[model samples]
Target: MFRFLNIVIISLITSIVSAQGYYDVTKYGIPNDSTFVGKNAIDNIIQKAVQKGGGTIYFPAGKYLTGSIKLESNITIFIDAGAELHFSDDFDNYIPMVPSRWEGTTVINFSPFFYAYKAKNITITGRGLIDGHGRNWWNYSEGFDDKKPKSKWENTFFENNKNVLAPPDSKWLKRGFLRPPFIQPMYCENVLIEGITIQNSPFWTVNPEFCKNVTVRSVTINNPHSPNTDGINPESCSYVHISDCHISVGDDCITIKSGKDEDGRKQAAPAEDYVITNCTMLSGHGGVVIGSEMSGGVRNIAISNCIFDGTDRGIRIKSTRGRGGVVENIRVDNIIMHNIKQQAFVLDTRYAKSTIGPVSERTPIFRNIHISNVTANTKDAVFINGLEEMPIEDVSFSNIHLEAENGFDIHYSKNISLNNVFFSGVKTSLVKIENSSDIDLKYLKLEKSTEEKPWVSAINVDGLFIDGCRPKKGTKTFLQLSGKTTSNIGFGTNDFRNVSQVVVKDYDVKKDAILK
Candidate 1:
């Protein structure tokens, strides 16, 4: 897709760790035939590479059936154009659980499908396929829908770590022995994953945890409707750049996570400085999602030039009360979404049900996010709900158009700005605002048929401003304001052409609350 920047620099592969060499797997006595267990032969090749300081482990055109492969420092696994590494489906091969983060909490679980720990300058690239035979894992986990029983390992994990897991997502213990990521490099530096097509991940595909200076491009991740098989997730990492990827997964297409509630708060490392662009998303829950797992924090991300087709939402940022994270400084632009199943965009703070406690370190925050130049054909659009105690702040939208059945539903948010926006095919009201203040709507457009109801409804809103929203044909009572708390409403230079009345106030609202 982005061929100009398609290839990784050679120094990224051969430098920063040691001298470089090349070792072919076939020369190590593993036949081209795919039947043999390739664990020993691949490990032998890796050992030779480590002995020579660093090298490229080559896999030529054929299938190699293997179990978990541990990556080492200063190494690259370059699969030829037709080569495929087919991971085994047996759960036992991944066991004697390793210490890794499962969902957000740290636990000893299955070895990552392909993993490295604290390594440096590692690369896995080439035009080949890395397939995780994930059907067995899904049948063991998400197959609860088909009425299957939990495996023995599930119970064993629950018996081991049940005391330590104080979960906002407490449901993890029930499934137990959590599924491993398709590819994970933990605590690594200068990592690059590119040009490979991955399929049928057991859990999240292309997940790098606690890694720095990571880049993933030109990769294709296609997983069916199994459970928790997200396409690409970068957790608690810094300086990440993801581009030119195609994803159609069972869950979210690309998600950024810092950590879970308590464990993440202890680590306190925010995932920062990410640039994601030029990606195509087909089927998933959300096109780009940030957290329900953010307890440490997430900030400074820019996403642009993306296409989301047949996904559930376009941009989703979610957190609960107990996960105390701040998601801010996010910018999304030049995006197209088609056939969105649910609301196209959302920033939900009360994502999970925890007893509403005092505003402490556990309270999550969302602020200073800007989205522009977006077009979506969705069922519903723009659902943003924040906590009453700590509302979402400083969110702005410009040049947005949506063809949808329903429209914006905003609650407990402040400092909102919508400029040059159009909502077409809206069966219900265009906007519904409650318990929010300082909302400015400029150049707003909507299509409405039955004119008895109000097109714009606001309740308990203060400091509302409407400007430059003039259309040729308009209905009576365009805006309806209610609630004793609604005050300081103003209209600036709006043409109410072909309309009888423009403002309507209920008994609760004072007449002086609105000014034009």
Candidate 2:
């Protein structure tokens, strides 16, 4: 009986402590007025909560203007429905450079708007809005004229600290000065951010770097057509889950990256084990993009049930020769894309200004990717361009239906399989293969356009197999073979309706290169 009473007493004490853990900002002398700078007051309240062994910092219905607010471990910032966290416009407000990575390169620069370092079990959840007030930052970066004199803020800090303002020998300096991201949690674990509206981010929004087990759900990101306003970028992080989000931004909607160039190769941390689902992308460079900065490599990513509307590209994977990394084991299923301006699916090794050189550890590799059940209407069906030295390998597509202006183009790739893939409104050749080998096409259907190109064109190809491929009626040529290096080409059970010629040889080749 005594032990039972002791248990009850301990439970009561725990409940009482939990009830008393709510720290209201108003009670802590943080005014609701929009003019007040609440950074110090808010930090004090967070520290108080941490002293009490973790709690929630509750913001009532008010507009609180603040600078950079650092987050601590085991703390939650909960804003009420009518509350607005407006970040300050003063550039000096984010002083004291912090260790952060800007556009894939690690540097010590300005802190992010909502910064967290090495925090665990941290959450930023509420039905309120976090506004970056990023117009000044954007103008400083985008609208700056070199002939004009600098603004007072710029003259004071940016001119005084050129090293801090720009990355080391970065190409981004030609575009403009660097700006901080909206939210960045570096080396954090068990982070959760949900039910928040983020807008007008100066740079990439919701970037979690070197973090693990991060969850971002039900968040709405709205950034205008400004430069480098990516929606959600998970860099060098593992076990990330992002779902049920609506993203409309200037750059890519979701860009998975590790490091960039030499810095990335040194870090050698891959962004892996990601599950992104149920997201809606309205406008961006690409709906889902991997790299341009993925030198550290990426693997084991799964994206499904996403909708891409009016984006420049639907799904894109891009890297260059110097960004030495390997991206493998990616699975994408059940995606819908409409009115994409570029190719529905693109894998290009020549992404940015990086060029090919002697193949080394810096040469990027992309392989073992599977995409299925995708329907897209775009300007181009698919484009896979790999380097001549290091080719992309082991990619497969199944159950894909695309209506595009141009058909598929494959170059310098190997072991690619397409099953049950259909394309319509192709202005160019139905399928074009160049310098590739070990390709298998089954159940491929093509609805050709008015162009007089061949239905299938192969150049410098080897081990090409076409099974059950059907072209539309009144095609001129069924197959056009070119390049003396072509060999072992096979056509099995194909239907060529009213084709003018079965084969057209563009180059003189050896016998037994083409097989029926």
Candidate 3:
């Protein structure tokens, strides 16, 4: 039944191509052989379509090998069922570099396999295969992100292509073999990528940068353990809707970004107003991630109805100091996760390259986020970390049912509320908190164990409140407070009859800090 439903959805999605006048590639004398390099023929066909005021270029029921395809405005490439659009593995096919962005930095690199720039009303649809033969690209580019390479030099690769590599300061000139994305539509509007299976990506797959009104639906992306092969990365784009996609790649499945540090701040474009729903992810770093590259700020994202299985983390939002971005107004609901290798939910703002300074534009900010209706089985339940200077603010978690090996950890945050949370299999001693304020726990059902453990352990924390929460039967300690700075803790209307003690404190904390 689900398969039939998918068929119906794909048929509906492909309707836009069906309505257009099609120029079949068979009629253009392109080779039918799978090994043929029909780059010129394909380019000529695209030119002809553009000359005729734009039309659908159709490839029907065969394997066609080609290189980079540059799309024009109002053009649609419809690959019919049983058709495979395979990209050539030869590096020479991607010569005469194009303007592109790689990992948040703008550069003139190898042409993306399917690229569109400043285009409007473009689409790639139909039930077909878009394969990037990327094994060779992966091998040649290995061990080069390192500043010092082990092997000797390839001077020609750098000397001949030095001018194309941008920023001059970038390491891309050194690693001249930085592979291109499978599909990247930059600065385009009204873009759609639907009803296709894309695999073997050399780098990111289905990446739409600086584009608006983008929709990627019913697309399946499968990449093996290739380096940096992310799926469905929409960077610096707005009004994006990504739904009904299946992704399993080496890196983050769906990474939302707005570029990185200095360049990102210069671009000053946030990847905001996004809706990601009804997607299934498998064997990736994070199911749905937002930035380690969000210096341009990311906001107003809503993700729902997603299933993540065998991913490293379920929902991850990560950035660091010196990023100079604000990530806020995010909502995540109705997510199911299993076999999460790391934390089920994490919001970390200290990833890499942090420096001590007064709070300014360099300090990344996270605020106004809510996550609810999540069920997960994972190694750790939650990990939330914020900076000391700029704490993460106004975050909420509700209706979460989780079975994790470790307990929750939070630090340097404020205005956090956890409601209707059911947690089990917590092997760690306490739900630890440090250097935070205004934390409220309501209607929580934490697992009870015979081991000596405190329900919550806090240090240097203030404005902590617990309401309508019942402790597991026969728990030893209710609250363990430490540090002389800790104060203003209130046990508000909670059932602690089965617990032994109300407050257990270290030598530094005063008993007057507790209000029961």
Candidate 4:
């Protein structure tokens, strides 16, 4: 009887909340005509809903032009099936430089089209579209374009500083030059964005910064081939879940970041506990990318059951020196890649141009990663380029198959293990090892192409072991050793066919290099 009474009480509360009725923007003096600007009317409606202890603000089947709409706690913005929210192209609409983070650095800039701050239990859901007419923004970023007119804000800002034409190379930029994101929620909790079609974002489409308990599902993102138009970027947030989304953008489909070089270390809020599954990626720079701005560190990430087609890179992790961070405990499984233009799997420690110096806390660290059950047809199979001062550590791959134009490139790494891995249709050496140590390969198979190169080449490697490796037919030399520092290489019982020489020294080094 107590449980029954509790259920009845909860149902009564829910009904009472629903009975508050939808606060239509048209009823609040906002017209459905496209000529009228609905910014004030929408803001008034949102305020009215908040005053009523939270309700739904509904937009029925029309095109509503607005500048920026701020959301409040316990409020839901619902657009009907045929309704479309069109953002104004004028730069003055996003005024009064709010406190925002631009690409991992904190600065006061223009407000996003849809902005929410420090609010809870907020949602934006419907079958309608939120469009950012971003052609003018994109053109201004690239320089003067004949198709777009110069905005008054742009003209005034540039007129004061006649020498400055565009944004500087630094990560942090002043106001009046930074383009805003489409939808941004900062320091909010219990956020849910579902079933909305977002297109032509000025910056990243949907960015949630410093938020928690966020869930984005069943959304569609379509950004044109413009600069910095990423699909969904979650920065310095925790407990994020993104699933069942279709994304086609110019930059990375889904990028996870914390912060940038010096500013990132100060914030020290790592992006953690993320789960991305059942997503389709097409025409992006990378399917899923981590860092370049991950100074606060990233951990406990799991990606599974995704498809990447016509992407530049399938899975990528990149960081440079001076970005002090540690990325660990990552697992990716059951991924399929087709027509990848670049490497299928890449861990680049030297992502961009940076001065090399002594190892310190500023140096980035990537380790403790496991990938399995992956199949890729790409141009390059795998590329691991770690820094010499701080090498990548403790990574493993199992049950993987790849067909690529080139092969694996491993450098400055340690404790790598590969089992049941196959490489086919490779024109270059099947595996190239450089400045690495403590490697193990088991049940490895290599199929050669027209280019007759050594199947395995090692330089300055120590404690290398190979077991049950099957080389392709008509191979002259199975192993090619170089550099004076190479030592302690061993091979177990393997299948060798039509090979003239088992080991060949490419340089004037020690003769006692191989052990069987």
Candidate 5:
């Protein structure tokens, strides 16, 4: 039966490749052995294939070193097992600062090592390696000798400094601020990247911006935990499928961002219809992140069957007020997390440089988020903070066994539901909602791990509900409601009659004194 299944799969793949039209790179001077300096050879082959109206460029079994290469339309690059393509580290070789798009605008800048622009039907497939030789670029200005540590470059933080802007003033200057991506393709369509080992990027790896109909499968992207070295960042792309990829890097493992604020809002192009499954994230800021730079808004994203280990956070969505974006229709399920240092989930709406600016129409809005079936050990189970002027709405959490040290904190939100959620903490409220409305908690089991730190009922909200909930033995202050409604007509003690509806069942609750 297994043999038959393998045969069927092979037949399907063969059919697909044959239909796509294959052209071997060896015919264009790419050597089968590791000794050949086939820099221009394979390039000529690709050009020939493009001139002949599209085909595949197969790299079969060798260590190939070359400078920057551009991919044309309707061409596929297939690197077989035991093949490695090491990019040239000499900055002078990558000349002219070609016409490329950075962030949002098209500008004359350093081209990506492997880039495709406004092209269609491109694929980079097979089990091989694309090494970025980043240490050479990182140490390009450090004046390090051959005797220095091979891992020294990975320890530096290059993204924070503002000196290295995109399209550096001169190639000779060591402006480390620019985190040059390894494999980037912008404004392309119908792209597929699968089954490759991509590593050692000087900046973000595997970035596809402003693209469509993209698919990334069975790929391993690894970088040495350097600053701004995010993996598989799909920005401003639509109809994307990223599955079976193991990403471990310095920054967010898989960050989904649309665009920067102001510029991104003006563009008005949302990154939508993306699905990520069967992936693993080892160490990073967040396992799967949706951006602080998402000014163009993001919607319709689903991530399932993922694992996160030793990350700062998991399933994070970050944006700021005045960013002018909308993030909605997000679903995350079937995740296992271990050793998460921060909150399991975060919805931070004030992410940028804080300022006292008038709430412009560009202020962002977050709603319709659902997370379920997650088992995590973290510091905080959840943290949701919305701007007072623009509150988040319609969020739900179900089937979560989150063991955290800091419980949960929510502020300036509405219409939240927590079902079948268990929290183990002490000296803190199992849940706290401040300046919120329509909050519901059902089947909540709060356990106290320490007696000195008694759990407190310091939650304050409007229209709150507590049904089928179990409180720990040391829980203090059953419930408190404060806020005036109407004039001099306090209804009853321990019950809020004039205020909005606040219901608590299967437990005792405190009532406020009526004032007339």
Candidate 6:
């Protein structure tokens, strides 16, 4: 039934495209010398295309400076190589707010520099540049304060019972939750954005919301090291294929987000079945981030053959307590991280802002995660902290080699498995597991970087299994509670003198030994 539904949807879209008239952009409007400079050439072309039933609007190789350019159905805007389509810096040029999506809400938002909405079979493909000319707008939006560092985007809420309020002093507009996204294409389908250098956006770049069959490949995304400049944010979309792309931005290189909190839960629209492969991220906050805005929930994501260099964190999955959603069945493989500043792999569920609130409807769940063959040189090897109230489960980490400042820290989780993993840290504990259950640690080696602080062990689990692992003796310690020990089992060369309930196979027994 679902397959049939998909087919019907595709057919309906095709019919709509056929019904629309098609016109070329250059034929409808020409860029002459007199009207070329400061002329609304792009708007004129788009209007003509819309009037004549949308078709491919071509941008030939030259510099075209204008304000916001709107896209229509069946319109394919082709930007050839050496073409530089720049956005005007005047704010009033983008006035008359258009229907758009900001943060998570659907509002009459400020239009993107290049905007498209509810369009079909739209293609913005070429080896050219679609520069947002964001520095002017970004500076202006932040009140043009050069002395202080500015942000890429800002979020503001509407007060006074859904009425549009102006910027004021007392009830002044403070920063809201949702950051504005750049290159926004909302409710668009059959989209193809290939081989374009989409850069310098004022905010999060390449945002495709409620879109489908979107193929973004061979694109180079370069932005300033500012706040909220994400490369691509595919929110509430499906069948997305992102490959052969080079992303270097201020925020997450490629982030997948849905909605946030109660607003997200009410939407209940998941961003599912997306594939990202063979991509390289040069510098960013995160290599790939799956949101705290996932109120609509996310599932069935696969990422492979990715390289992260000089990033703050790699493979980061972060969410708050109240955001209620389930992010499961994620598979990441063949990842290589170099010079990661923070934790190489992290699942932080305690992303709270106010530090106090009820269990929000946006409480999210992360489980059934499988990661393998990940090599990294970083400050911290691994960091996984589930919600103390709700434990994360069914996670596996295998064949990971880390050269870092700290070791693994796993807390408040269940059904955890670690195999063939090694960590080398001089001043920190090699492994620390607390308030967990069914942990299977096998073929592990925790080596000391220097003799100052040797390999220290802190394992607190209900059921634990240690097999074929090598940890430095004399300094390794274990602490436990009697009621917490369910089954402490080991395979070869077992050391369980400090454990409460212990069973060993082929181990030299040292009875009444103090574990430290």
- State TM-scores per candidate: 0.93, 0.92, 0.92, 0.90, 0.81, 0.81
* Candidate 1, residue 41: how far the Cα is off, in Å: 2.2
Residue-level lDDT of model 2, residues 204-263, one tens digit each, is: 999999999999999999998788899999999999999999999989999999998888
On TM-score, the leading prediction is 1
User: Candidate 2: global Cα-lDDT?
Assistant: 0.87
On residues 1-516, what C-alpha lDDT tens digit does candidate 4 reach at each position? Answer: 999999999999867755785687877778777778788788888898898778898988899899988899988999878889999998888876576777887665678988899999889999988899888888877664434665566555444434422224563233346788888899999999999888889988889999999999989999968778888889999999999999999899999999887778888999999999999999899999999889989999999999999999999999998888999999999999999999999998999777878998799999998999999999999998888888899888899999998878999998888888888888887778999988887887765523377878889888689888766567787788888878889888888765777788966557787764
RMSD (Cα, Å) for all candidates, in order, is 5.7, 4.4, 5.9, 5.3, 7.9, 9.1
lDDT of 5 at 196: 95
lDDT of 3 by residue, 14-61 (tens): 675544557788888886668678788988988988887898889999
Q: What is residue 41's positional error in candidate 5, in angstroms?
A: 3.1
Q: Model 6: per-residue lDDT, tens digit, 115-174?
A: 788888887888988777677655555554434543323222232114432212212134
Enumerate residue pairs that collide in model 5.
Answer: 324-362, 494-511
Worst 10-residue lDDT window, candidate 4: 164-173
- Superior candidate under lDDT, 2 versus 5: 2
Error of 1 at 498 (Å): 2.4
Cα lDDT tens digits, model 5, 1-516, are 999999999999978875566666665666665565455676687887887788988888888877677788988888899889887776644543554434533344556777788899988998999888777656653453434544322223222222323322233224322335777888899999999999887677888888999999999988874666788888889999999999888889998887766557766778899999999998789999998767788999999999999889998999876567889999999999989988789998977656545677568889999999999999888899888777889999999898887766888888888888887653466676677777777777665533332222323455665556545444444444434321121222232222232322222223432233
C-alpha positional error of residue 102 in candidate 1 after TM-score superposition, expressed in Å:
1.0
The C-alpha lDDT values of all candidates are 0.87, 0.87, 0.87, 0.85, 0.73, 0.71
Clashing pairs in 3: none
Question: By how many angstroms RMSD does model 3 differ from the true structure?
Answer: 5.9
> Could you give me the TM-score of model 4 versus the true structure?
0.90
Off by over 4 Å in 6: 1-40, 50-53, 141-180, 353-360, 446-456, 471-516
Q: Candidate 3 — worst ten consecutive residues by lDDT sum?
A: 150-159
- Residue 482, model 1: lDDT of 91
Question: Which regions in candidate 1 have their CA more than 4 angstroms from the true location?
Answer: 1-20, 143-163, 166-169, 447-452
lDDT of 5 at 377: 90
